[model samples]
Target: MPRPICSQCQFLIQQCLCDHLSVVKSDIELVIMQHPSEVGHAKNSVRLLPHLLDKVRIVVGETEQDFAQLKAELEAESRPIYLLYPSEQSVEASQVKHSQQGILIVLDGTWRKALKLLKFNPWLLSFQSLHFSPQAPSRYRIRKASRIDSLSSLEAAAFGLQALQPQMDIKPILSAFDAMIEQQLVHMPEHVQARY
Candidate 1:
């Protein structure tokens, strides 16, 4: 039988991360467009995002039709909507003007899947794209990244939010991610853990 999972934390009963979560309130609005496959993936970092941000919307899908309503909602919003993807046209996150709180949309998926999501949802291209150079390497050790500089969605959001609002504490924003890594590391074999 499958191990019982916590409905809230989505981890095995004993490994639930709900208790490890730390909340950070940000004035900016965040919208995470997650591919369907990432919803329950063990190493998925987007899981820690809602616990980190005070205001976050997690929309799961990878198609234009799936995101139609969200697109409409974004279109109607008066606040500046920015896409957190590094397109040829994207500007550095630090270059973003920080006058007022605005909606920031992040794609939560592997690079290939993120590209697929972008292709499927072309409307996303219309928004101003923002990219950031990772200040540090990824703490996401369990998964292998195709690129060296890639940060997990949680890490990306944390850094992105930091760029948008320099006053935000980086520690609390990343506490759950660190905790999740610790939890996963505990389950790994010592020999395997040593490799990471």
Candidate 2:
């Protein structure tokens, strides 16, 4: 084996491409919950995704129990809840409009980690699953996925919010994220050259 190379962008950097970030407008409240390992990880994008959006909140897990409480608190806001996980059995977010009284929850992690979250947290499963079909390959260069349709948290947020609020111009936010990624990538090669 070639030391378990990153499947996405194929660069290591702790296998993350999270520096690019954006926030989108949505009438429904959006919450992104990430696993514990992701907090200190250089590639972690979950934290950045929420900051880009107007009403997005992100919470990282220090313990599963705390995250559970947080989820309950978020869900208690008296709105329809949906989780973004693409599955044939799951209800797609595009198929339904949340209107004024809904909350959409997104989880960020590796595929295995996401599956673990779904397995350990039954309350999370209680929400209707929000499935999305993206038109582009994930911009994340660090970790690869089997599907080109998969997108980063920020990218997904843009598409989802665009779907929800067609009037909002989220282009600037997306452009900013793209610039950040390019800047970071440019600096990375120089650092490598210096070491050689």
Candidate 3:
């Protein structure tokens, strides 16, 4: 039989980590373009964004048509929007400055898939890009990522948003990520756990 799931965190009922969550209550707007393959995947990190940023929006699709509405909505907003992606053209997240809060767009998927989203949605390139100089390595050890330095969407959101809004508290987001990893770790075999 399938274990009952928590409607909020989507973890098994017994494994629900919602108790570890605390509301950040920030006005920071976040739009996450999630690859369809990642939508319901258990390892998806962007799922944790709502617990941190109450106003986060997650759109599930990969092509331009999938994001046309989002693109139009973004165009109507006069506030600055920054894409949290790493590239030679991207500046450190801390360098972005504006008089008012801005929106953050993040791609949620593996490195290759994320690049594919970028390719399929060229409009995403118009936004200013920002990257992080992370203080630590990725905490998402349960899943394999293409690059050793790749961070989960939740981690990138927390760090990237922190750079833009220096006063926002990100510990709750990070703690939830750790707790989820620990939950998944308990289910893995000793051999699988050793690889991470």
* True-structure RMSD, every candidate: 1.6, 7.8, 1.4
Candidate 3, residue 92: how far the Cα is off, in Å: 1.2
Q: For candidate 1, what is the lDDT?
A: 0.87
With candidate 1 superimposed using the best TM-score fit, by how many Å does residue 48's alpha carbon deviate from the native? 1.3
Per-residue lDDT of model 3, residues 1-196, tens digit only: 8879999877788779889988786656889999999988978778777776777999999999999999999989898999999999999988777887679999988898999999999998999999988888788888877777888888888888889888888988888889989988888889988997
After superposing candidate 1, which stretches have Cα over 4 Å from the reference?
190-195
Candidate 2 positional error at 159, Å: 1.9
- Which portions of model 3 miss their true places by more than 4 Å? none
Tens digits of per-residue lDDT, candidate 2, 105-158, equal 777777667778777776777777777677667676644566667677667766
A best-first ranking of the candidates according to their lDDT comes to 1, 3, 2
Task: Output the better candidate (1/2) by lDDT.
Answer: 1
Between 2 and 3, whose TM-score is larger?
A: 3
Error of 1 at 121 (Å): 1.0
In model 1, what are the clashing residue pairs, if there are any?
none
The best-first sequence of candidates by TM-score reads 3, 1, 2
